[model samples]
Target: MNRFWPISWQRGGLSLIIAALLVFGTVRLFTNAPEVALILGEPWEDMRQRSSAKIDPAIPGSYWGRVITSDARLRLIDLQYGFVTPRARFFTVSFDDNERVSSIRMSPQIEPLLLDDTLKVVLDLQEQWRKGGWIPIRVNYDPPFADTPEWRAQLRNVNKGGTSYWQAGNKYQVMMVVNRFKDERNPTEERYLIKLQLATPWVSQ
Candidate 1:
């Protein structure tokens, strides 16, 4: 295992399960992956209905629930099994008072063995959105990364990291990044959080 994958960040119990899945490829679990990019302004009820339907009886941790936050209400997804869907691990959807989706976030779990593999998938996914006219906004999250032409030029050498903020035709706000951070509790280990946050006022393409 890479020094990054460890028994930290409350993900310790998963270490063995993830390792086991890696060892016996034939026994792999698979399922339909959720789309990481979200459609802002979607009806909360409709979105909640679709999410609630994805639970698996076989995976006890598989669940979607709602919560109220200081700023907005949210739908949280905790899907524990779906190896076939790559890193489709968890999600959070926040909605406005009108019950329209105000933002959607996808935070996929990445294993050490598949860091590069997963990073490639994420960057490719971002490229697809770029092709659809999702250009980087003027500002972004902190970096050792950029989504500009100069930065994208290094795609061939991308390992598992970047920070990019973007917008599409004045309709949405996006932040896509592969963040690598060390757990203070486990200083020697490194981990990556592959996240995509899409935010907007009520509007749709």
Candidate 2:
């Protein structure tokens, strides 16, 4: 018998070879991935539908049932702002009269982290949004952050009140606010809050 054909043509070695070829072809098909950017550039109407589907306002009770119900005090600030220390960051979820999700506020206490900690988070978020093809649009704030000396000194503007508020959003009506505050414990140190407010079309009375 020849060494190459020692296994014998009558044997099932041919079947194993065919199976290996099929597996390799299937893997190659999946390896050639499609461009996500092209696919995700959907029409505004489609994007709106997708966004609304995330938090169906038509739903009866508060969409954040379990999330807010878990903390008794969390519910106290339904329309107003409430404070809660959950996990590593402070969390606050708000709901409209219809019990729909209105906004979510989160802040990382900077006393424990480096000075540029919040700046890093904001930059990373911006990069991700840009990658997703969303651009931030400047929105007017009632008591804008432009007033603060820190802000004015850096930004060259001022407002009436001491509090500073900066807001921006994309076409999807999603707004993000970056707030700077003096650390409670360490007065000299600063802390920041990145409040992501979902500008749902539903307006509260």
Candidate 3:
């Protein structure tokens, strides 16, 4: 990363013009990277090379995007298919190396939602997916899968109006996770967030 910056600058008037050009070029290069659909089955290494992609060391095999940057905002489920998704802070994606499986993306809700709203939105998506030919099955989680959320992930059962979905299928494995978060300013008050993950089925990958 450091290589992207100029290491030395002579203390002269020429330095200012050179510095300006370098910075402008760098920003243009990043901004020029096109933000497109997270195609499933695309090579992970390929996406990593995109200037707009952001990779967090903590989450391997996953990236937050060229499109969903901190300043970038897009609400995709905006009644496009008769279903609207809960507003999210941002999204992260995952991919595999099959016949180009599905592009997996996870979105965390920006704010706490009433348990009722969570259920309604999740059910709406499930029904839509069902009609689209995706089957629902019990989710069998692995090590980091359970620990993906930074908040308390224990409140994931829909029965008590907690987490919404927890299964996967061919078309998409959508999970609406209800998480408990500690309010920094008000510790006594518990805040809950919805974590949505859309992925291509393992069978497809």
For all predictions, the C-alpha RMSD in Å is 11.6, 24.8, 15.0
Task: Give per-residue CA lDDT, model 3, range 80-193, as digits (tens).
Answer: 222234333344443332322234333333344444444454455567555655444443331112223421234443233233333333334454544444434445555444
* TM, every model: 0.50, 0.38, 0.44
lDDT of each: 0.41, 0.30, 0.36
For residue 195, model 1's alpha carbon misses the true position, in angstroms, by 2.1
Query: How good is model 2 by TM-score?
Result: 0.38
Worst 10 residues of 2 by lDDT: 30-39
Q: Which numbered prediction scores highest in lDDT against the true structure?
A: 1
What digit string (tens of lDDT, one per residue) describes model 2 on residues 1-205? Answer: 1101111221233232222222211111112221111011122233224331122222344333112211111111212221122121233333433543444333322122222554454445445445554444442332323333464343222122122222222212233344444334445655344443333222111
For 10-91, candidate 1 gives per-residue lDDT tens digits of 2442333233223222211123433322245555565645552332211123222232211111222212211112343344
Q: How does model 1 score by TM-score?
A: 0.50
Comparing 2 with 3 on lDDT, the higher-scoring candidate is 3
Error of 3 at 176 (Å): 2.9
